[model samples]
Target: MYLLILGLLMALLKFLEFGFLAEVSWWWVLVPFGLAALWWVWADSSGYTKRKAAEKIEQKKRDRIEKHRESLGLHKRRH
Candidate 1:
């Protein structure tokens, strides 16, 4: 995400001929975008994305269950 944002900022700067970015090649300005793409491919193939998504879903489920229990006045007792 950061890489993409940075790349976009650089691209915009280059397009507007601002600062030193004005002299930079378009290919250089686009490097961050390429890196971001590679990172996404690696993360997806390594299951990192799926694991994070699964964890998020599990957390939501737990939160919903807790809310339901509270609504029913069914709280867990501390030992």
Candidate 2:
């Protein structure tokens, strides 16, 4: 997935001339490249977003449980 995205980005960058999209006789090619770029960004960002969100939730739960245990002055002992 990453490879394909990188490839498309490279292609688009190569196609651009002087910081502008090259005027291609066939315009339809631009559509796929644009879509690919959008997909790549969305895919990359969503994974990190989900991971961070999950970590935040887990940490909150852990903190709450720890606070509860501390208030009770209880801990598990291994002997």
Candidate 3:
């Protein structure tokens, strides 16, 4: 995501003839996008994305359970 944003910014700067960026090659300016795509491919193949998604779901479940427990006066609030 960061890489994609960086790539877009670089491309924009290059297109607009911004000072230093205008002097850079198109290949250099487009590298971040390639990196971002590679990152996505690696994350998907390594199950990183799936694990992160599962972690989010688990956190939501825990939060819901804690809320229910607190409502029932069975959970203590952290100081």
Candidate 4:
């Protein structure tokens, strides 16, 4: 995400001919975007995306259960 954001910012700056970025080649300005794409590919292939999605789904399930218990006037028992 950070890489994506940075790449976009640099691209915008270069496009607008801002300061040092004005002298930068389009290829250089686009390097960050390429890097961001590579990072995403690596992350996806390594199962990071799947793990995070699973964790998010598990959290939602836990929240739903807790809300249902509360609505039914149930209390959590101590272990």
Worst 10 residues of 1 by lDDT: 69-78
What are the per-residue Cα lDDT tens digits for candidate 1 across 1-79? Answer: 9999999999999999999999989999999999999999999999999999999999999999999998998979689
* Candidate number of the best lDDT: 3
- After best superposition, candidate 4 residue 26: deviation in angstroms? 2.6
Candidate 2 TM-score, true structure as reference: 0.39
**Per-prediction TM-score:** 0.89, 0.39, 0.94, 0.85
Task: Assess the local accuracy of residue 22 in candidate 4 as a C-alpha lDDT between 0 and 100.
Answer: 99
lDDT of 4: 0.93
Q: Model 2 segments beyond 4 Å from truth?
A: 1-46, 75-79
lDDT of 2 by residue, 9-63 (tens): 6557646642334443335444666666787688677796578788999999999
Ranking by lDDT: 3, 1, 4, 2
Angstrom error at residue 10, model 1: 0.9
Q: What stretches of model 1 exceed 4 Å from their correct place?
A: 77-79
Off by over 4 Å in 3: 77-79
In order, how many clashes per candidate?
0, 0, 0, 0
lDDT of 4 by residue, 1-79 (tens): 9888999999899989999999989999888889999999999999999999999999999999999998998958789
Error of 1 at 70 (Å): 0.8
